[model samples]
Target: CHYCTFVTVPGKLRRAGHGMFLSPDEVLAIAREGAAMGCKEALFTLGDRPEDRWPEAREWLEAEGYDDTLAYVRAMAIRVLEETGLLPHLNPGVMTWTDLQRLKPVAPSMGMMLETTATRLWSEPGGPHHGSPDKEPAVRLRVLEDAGRSNVPFTTGILIGIGESYEERADSLFELRKTARAYHGIQEVIVQNFRAKPDTAMRGMPDAELEELAAAIAVARHILGPSARI
Candidate 1:
């Protein structure tokens, strides 16, 4: 069984409605409901360090009595584990060594999409990750390394149809495999195809064809070897 959780706050908190943010009590209640429904894992999906991006985000965290988003998440994870019996899996995006160390004990596992290893897209006008500071490929790789150093079970993968060449997709998978082999922390690799959404930067972009997706998955399997889970 699977369940999910989101901080619900956008990077710019002012851009979101008041109802978007969920209180700690609300999170616990949802966890209890998930436990009753036989859900065994909870995924914490939220903005990556929104407090650093917007003043309103910082204000909200302060108002909630949390010094930072990671602290708040750690507390929620512990609460969910103690009260609801669901293992917490976090997707907090790019993190530092300290962040990984702090989260490792509370979250049994964690993840972040490698998306792509291509840095060229970041410079393209109106590219999917153009303005996102945390989307830097090198930064994301560092997070993976730090997670490995912390001995955390990790999940990571490449994103297709994001203006990356087939070669770049293979590069991303190879990079992930190298890190996984070195650290032994990567437990799963996901091959995700990008779907353009409305009112976003890549809305007009085309989705990956089935053939392309299959090829990418094959590359992942080949690079990650038989011992890896895909």
Candidate 2:
């Protein structure tokens, strides 16, 4: 059975009071429940260092007895392992080598979506990753490199239909393949199609067509080969 739980935290892209801010105990309790209900994995998805961008996030972390979001996540991950025995898969956005090392012990795996390697998205006004510093392709690639150096099994992939050209999508897949070959630590590549939400910045963007998604998957399979899971 595959069951999962998400631990939400403030993100750089989110406005103040955007989501629930959970305490360590609260997070642990959720993990325990998930375990009791037969969950095998817990995904800790947090904003990439919300404290750096939002004063409210920083104050909340400090008041909660954590120096930073990663510290809080580390403690919660340890608790999830020790108390519930679920393998934690962290998707806490961009991370450094030191951050990966710190949480690697408790987490069996971690992930971040490369989204796309196109720099134009960053420069484009109202682009998907516009204003989201942590969403930079170079920074995300560096995180993948760091994860490889740390020998951590990682999950990464591309987000299609986010204002990227077909060529850009291919480029993204190729970059992932190169990184995976170099590190041999990439466990899976998730080929996710973007779904625009009603309240988000990309609300008006059309979803990728079925044929486009199929083509993207075919490209990923060809580049990453049989060993890669897409």
Candidate 3:
């Protein structure tokens, strides 16, 4: 997303494709160490589908005998579970029913940030989500429903700031509540505030104030209720 400041290798570095992923053995070794350090859950928060964006990602996957990043993640999740005895919580972005089903056996939970349901941010030019296809509200809501249908414990939430109005924030929480009420698979909802970074596309955007976060959290509580973990 345009507002994101997460460390990622895009464009030139992605095209260069010089780096390689650690082998499964190496990943398991780290997980095992984490388990020794009393970490019971191995959280995997990955960038969405880099292979779809860069051919280098595809080439790297092919070199490793995987067709896509999701399959690689599933395989790694299985390895983490079997070798390290750490429960895996995946956040591989928007996923389909089949993808959820495939990852469910190894992953106890998964998450994807809903951000907001405002189509304006996604459809209008110069908006935070305009060029980001995975940030599409319909697609994200579909993922939520699919996770519910699959009986997977899921985490999701609305992001405050980023130019969405209070109404859009409320609507996003309500959408989450609707899915939670239907399938009871939602484990938690996070109310996150945007913290723009100097290096990001949203560097000039104002940071979300405490008032906005408090308001959003209050509304989330009202919509999702006291029983809901927010």
Candidate 4:
């Protein structure tokens, strides 16, 4: 549930050591939240959004003078990856296989995944992803399969509670599993219940019920247990 949000640079802007200075308190907060939820592993990621202005976000980063900090984080991430040691989950959102291949020399063992679970934007009549749902899955699978071919062992997750249905969740898992098999190595599956964070578009929207979460996990476990690690 602590996945990073990369709505700013294309792929490499707010990763580990970038201007993003996470405090000990922040790390502890993440660890506590993850442990409280019975999670065996904690997650972390870099933020990248190539399409937006990010006036406020940029100002904050500039104030922090992240040049040196980012360099250090990059080195640390590389160490973790190269050693194949799990340091939470490393998320590089909406990235291509070519880009991921470049990442392999750094953190081979750390978990990597595509951030395909963001909420849909319906406000803009003709937005970037207006009709993206149909084609995005295939594009995502192509990349996942590539990760498999390299033996990088990765996983896929989703954004639930954003008006997605029981059937949709089941279908998404089924499709991800199918895609993962084609790729070769999948470690685990994660499901995040949608929470309407304050100031977000769907802030006032209701989240999914407990029954929905339980049902989804049960279904996924049943469906993915035989072959891949779920």
List candidate 3 segments past 4 Å from native: 10-22
Q: How many residue pairs clash in each candidate?
A: 0, 0, 0, 14
Candidate 3 lDDT tens digits, 63-178: 99998999999999988998889999999898988899999988999988888999999999999999889999999999999999999999998889999987888889889989
- Residue pairs in steric clash, candidate 3? none
TM agreement with the true structure for every prediction:
0.91, 0.89, 0.93, 0.61
Q: On residues 104-202, what C-alpha lDDT tens digit does candidate 4 reach at each position?
A: 665433343333422343223342234434225556556667777877768666556655456656777776777666766777677767665664444
**lDDT agreement with native, every candidate:** 0.82, 0.84, 0.88, 0.53
Model 4 misplaced stretches (Cα beyond 4 Å)? 1-44, 49-74, 79-89, 110-135, 226-228
- Judge candidate 4 against the unseen true structure and give its global Cα lDDT, from 0 to 1: 0.53
RMSD of each: 4.1, 4.8, 2.1, 7.3
Q: Name the lDDT of candidate 1.
A: 0.82
Candidate 3 — what's its lDDT?
Answer: 0.88
119-190 per-residue lDDT for model 2 (tens digits): 878767767677767777899999999999899999999988888999999999999998999989999999
**CA lDDT of 125 in candidate 2?**
70
Q: 62 in model 1: Cα distance from truth in Å?
A: 1.1
Q: Against the true structure, candidate 2 has what lDDT?
A: 0.84
